[model samples]
Target: MTASHAPFIAACTELLGASHVLTHDHDTEPFLVDWRKRYRGNACAVLLPADTAEVAAVVGLAHEHGVAIVPQGGNTGLAGGATPDESGAQAVLSLRRLNRIRGIDPHNNTITVEAGVVLAEVQSRAESAQRLFALSLAAEGSCTIGGNLSTNAGGTGVLRYGNTRELCLGLEVVTPQGDIWDGLRGLRKDNTGYDLRDLYIGAEGTLGIITAAVMKLHPAPVARVTALAGLASPHAALDFLAMAQRHAGALLTGFELMSDFSMRLVGRHFPQLRYPFGEPHAQTVLLELSDSESDEHARALFERLMEQAMEEGIVEDAVVAESLAQSQAFWDLREHIPLAQAEEGLNIKHDIAVPISSIGRFIEETDAIIARATPGARMVTFGHLGDGNLHYNVQAPEGVDQKQFLEAFQTPINALVYDQVHAHRGSISAEHGLGQLKVDEAMHYKSAVEVRLMQSIKAALDPENRMNPGKVVRWAQAGTRKENIA
Candidate 1:
């Protein structure tokens, strides 16, 4: 669109070949739009590099041209982290071409993979070697490992294995200045100064483009059991989780909380899925157990725990999967929440996290607050209860215009939910990074000092603000000068 953008596009094309450079409107359209379709941006072009060297070359070219570069991986991010701004001066660097699993060391319990490798592929590869890649998510089929690491993705397995940041042993990144930081080491313990790998893990691509990563892996569980438990209330669900954790210990892999609304949504949207319980309880907890021991032993242990929980009044009812097929079906119901919600209608979602102990109270109070503020709003809450993260969503009441409700109550509703999270010392963004969606709102809760420190780090790493600008860090010259301001 601009007379000056010709050279920038030309440079990118020269670095990544004409085939790899996507300048046509049709070719770059998908990269410009976000997953939620909430934001649409304009990028001059999209660059697809085949390897780390080519990525470094393309990033170097963009740096020299003084054009912004938005690093994208599968474009599966919930927040618009990969979407460029409206300026049309940026180029989206797609990592899809770099899909490769370089190495899997079973003895070392690590896997080195390219950023573009889909999460499901990584899991499968690990499984093939009798190992387990525990970082699991609903979007694993399409979400790229690079995007997962960039967002520091947390899913059900996070309760046992940890987030992407913890799973990542090292990363190979192309910095804003076009320099490649080859820090891809699989060391179990490295006390080298400054954990630079972490800086880009959840930076949302603002710092650099992750080309590849050395990820941790675990031994495949020989035995596994899945249980669906009915609870009296959110408090009861938490009590069940505490009791289960006390008995199951590290074997308790996943503890998810689902409300009655969530179950109805699933049953309505996914008719194929039969409700495990005959009657709708106040809440449900999908509990998972995994061990290297025998399957029978694992199932017996889970059954015993469930019986004990029922006797203690922690569990209203429970069902332990007798077979692997049954176990997967239970997980299918839990993992399909997003899909089910999508089919139902428009809703405002808050992926908030609170203290484990305060989650029950927070949910009760927040539900009451939401009902009072926005009457007729249907609350659908569920998520990794063990980790204190909840997909607290508010659906527009029946026969109401979704857009109008969103326009009127989005901010207020978010504040209401987030305030409770803040009060409980929880995170507004539990798994998703602060992309364009929450950049401004994050300021309201984060302290001036904390914001300044983040800004300073961004300025220090990406002074020109060419790498995924206008993300995690607020990029104003005045704001960058933290010391001068205060």
Candidate 2:
């Protein structure tokens, strides 16, 4: 340990016990890096705070010492949001120990949970209550509620429900100044004064530490029907989505887009799972219909839509999941694309979004752009088609060095894709919040006034920029003092 951080580490050890404070390189290495392995950082220590009070104490101590904090949960983020910087002065605050579901009120349909609560556990608890916690993602097994809320995550359910911001009613946040804001109101209507709950939700921990949250819940779906349909192109896929929306409407809970290349990669990597389609198709849609009525109703709605789609030539081939196992298998194919891509090689990933109408053009143009620019680069494109978010990723060619391709083309490809995204009035980041990966890009695409407003918010909340520095909005311009405060 460095001589300067000795007392700070000792104070943390004193507060949360010596065992809870990790200073050793081996003990803290995992927490220092992001899930993508794209960013590896260094920290003076990792402090595990067991509860809200403990977290408050940790924040207070860090504030007193003027030390920055990088609040991390599960370490499953892709944008390097949780990882600390190369500077070894910051402290990685681990929130994994505060995994508690405080309450579940069936009448009000709300679930109060600690920040460190795993997303899958919350879903299970909701199911036990005969309700549903709608915020679900691929990382639900390990991703924590705090991280999800911090990122304002949008998963497949976003089509029917909403993002984490809409899922959450209130939050228990510890401000950068170490003061607790117990605004955990379960009320659906609160029009009094400024909405402080929102300020912390998608701030990516740059404003404050979200210790717990009151999340909105919904009545459990009595039935769900899953289907994988083949399409000739993204244009056809858009038409398919439009037709599904017209037929099923709100019951059409999910509509995911998967390129043929993405499905091919999955098939090549994982042979055990049943592939979605046998023949070649340019694009496919993983659509689902859910209802609070009976299974027959959901199946009837899905079948009617599929029949109409086939007649209209929107769907070339389709498979309806007759059983729960079949439905899960269909989802399994969609969920494992990232795993398959990882198994293939280093991938330069882009979490992007465009209007549903423009998605076809977006894909066609970007696909051509990537192919023409980078020869033989494998494009794995898939994501929440209903809500317009796509995980458009790229892999090096058959024999190109993965690292070399990423190093050479990462910048230009990002610019090309993001430029097209902005040109189409789309977002560079839709579901995944702008972490370290796209902060600079955010400043670029975002208007000067908008960026200034955001910077003012961050500076107002955290004057010293001690809270999750360099992830969302970093300190711009000289002097640490807050000038022209909002």
Candidate topping TM-score: 1
TM-score of each: 0.97, 0.96
The residue-by-residue lDDT of candidate 1 on 1-486, one tens digit each, is: 477889978877777789988888999899999999989999888888899998888888887878888999989888898899999988889999999999999999999999999999999999999999999988899999999999999998988988899999999999888899999999988997999998889998998999999999999999888989998899998888888888889999999999988888999989898778888899989989998998887878887898899998888888888788988999988877888989877899998888889988998899899989988899999999998889999999888999899899998888888888889998989998889888876766788778777887888889998989888767765564443223
lDDT by residue for model 2 over 169-246, one digit each (tens)?
A: 999999988899999999999999999998898888999999999999999999888999999998898888888888
TM-score of 2: 0.96
**Which segments of candidate 1 are over 4 A away from where they belong?**
480-486
The Cα local distance difference test for each model comes to: 0.89, 0.90
What's model 2's overall lDDT?
Answer: 0.90
For candidate 1, give the lDDT of residue 38: 88
